[model samples]
Target: MSTRPPFTLYGSNASPYSCKMRALMRYRRLHFTWVPLNPMEMASHPNPNIRALKAKVIPVLEWPDGRVLNDSTVIIDALEAEFRDGRTVVPPAGPARFLAKLLEDFFDEWLMKAMFNRRWSSEVDRDWSGRWIISDQLMSAPELVTLPSPSQTSGLIKFFRDRQVGRLALVGCEDDKLWQHVMYEVVGALDMQLRSGDACRFLLGPHPTCADFALFGVLKQLSLDHTAGRFIQDHFDAAYGWVLAMDDLSGLETDVDWKSLHMDTPAVKKILKLISAMYMPYLVANGKATRGEWVEVEFHLDDGQTFRHKEKFGPYQKKCLDDLKRHYEQLTAS
Candidate 1:
């Protein structure tokens, strides 16, 4: 076995979580390689570039010992455990740590909903998805690649919007400028609260912690597109710039410039929940009860499985962690 620390990342250049992981690797100087994922493929298929790890999702981190960790948070946790060189990605313990997690969750899930809603809501997104999101090698004919229909687009937009009903959802009624205004305000609020009169320039101080990268990940996503992406780059320019600094420290590879990568592509339009929420409740219908308990939910993407989802969650979240754990235990039982 090679004694060198083995780190392999399964993610795409466009994935924000992947970017977050990349930023972490560079920040801490962790060693790792990256793998990109493309749809329309099986493990052995000559096309689709790469197959998704769990139902075609990205950001799967594989360790040198062959331990595969899914979800950005979980992977980050794994990094902290293995890279115990005294360099900490989180504060020394206190309210700062708690606040970091809360706010990170808020921005990661909520803000993503708003930003991508606008990106995918346009005609530009529809045309672009064809060019970038799907896999060309998977299909014999370029025209054969399928995309979400016009009506599907409208429904997806509405789906994200409606899900924000109860949450402190903050996109401004489908208008990009309004959305930017709100986004800028939110970032300002975080900057004020975290740094409030402290000598620390980062969210905690001195060292970049989880809070710093968490905010950066969400903000990075916001800045991905230049056309409708002016909110973070324009209003929160300083804070947005910090994301690059963190990315340098992080160990992931990102191709596009923060200010220049946004385009009208179907991939940009589609808002994906983190794999962690795969079992979480998702919003499906208005005025309906969602998969209230995490223990009962299991998200499926296939035709028969997808239909079983209750749209009542209104983009709600659920996770059957215990059940999954039990199942895992059973499978490994001797």
Candidate 2:
């Protein structure tokens, strides 16, 4: 029998999957030892972490009693099933369980594309692309992974953009005047439920359950609370506060070494930057700002008088918005 404690984690702290378990345990206050793992580390371990798991992935959980777990959902569920110390991620399993699963997968898969695409987007100079690229730009770059060929990444992006990803996102095709409103509404709904009052912190209940952690994974993609756009303030007072309670997971792009970006291409980078810039403004006009709180972004066409969304925004607004349509279409089609 291994001398390790009842909980031992063979994974890296930086991994999203790993973080899912870590965050769950953090709120639950479960004690576990994190045994670090990477491709290289796994290769050398004749113990064969891969052989035990059908595929290559991180965040394998091994209990001190000699039980091993693979897959984040499996691990969390197993823990919830076997060890319910009066704190559960959900009430007796039912529709809530299934909804939690769907939400977790949504954040993990669908949101990843937008998150990936946003990284390369910036008004970066040409010279900087070569120097900064993935390696230099990252706050803590992963070991340079020999990812699939650049051509392969392009193919995947094309496939993801065209066929695979958007089907689920468009399951809720919005016809709102501004897309940000629709996006934040969904976020706001979840936040409102979680933070029933200023004090009600957990999204589901007293402690974060699997459902809560799953939502956290997706929300992590959006920027931090300090973002210029008062996305939280405008949409729902609790949008930022609820997420903050879960520990901010929004700052993932800065630390990852993403593949498939053509940083050398200035136009592409500008497009990306444009996408990010639009988010703040989009949040303002479309999201939580009531008419009373709203400030007009443009002057009246007839008079110097300004108005909120109705007239202040002009051809320039239309121009920027038109540009956004193409990007959203790209995202939607993806």
Which candidate has the highest lDDT of all?
1
Residue by residue across 1-334, what tens digits does model 1's lDDT show? 1247857776655566777777776666667776564323336434233333454555667677766666676677677776665455643334444434444454555455545554455556434433333322223333445755556555544444344332322221243443443354456554444344533455543455665676677666656654445655665555665666666753433331222222222211122222223322332121234444222234454333231222223332223233333434544552
Candidate 1 stretches greater than 4 Å from native? 1-3, 39-56, 125-182, 190-199, 250-289, 292-316, 319-334
Clashing pairs in 2: 89-209, 121-272, 161-334, 166-334, 234-288, 235-288, 298-312
TM-score of each: 0.57, 0.48
CA shift at 48, candidate 2, in angstroms? Answer: 2.3
Give the Cα error of residue 322 in candidate 2, in Å: 39
lDDT tens per residue, model 2, 106-213? 444323333332222222311222222322213232454654455544543444334422332332112222334324534656655545443334433334446557
Kindly give the stretch of ten consecutive residues in candidate 1 with the minimal lDDT sum. 261-270
Candidate 1 backbone clash number: 28
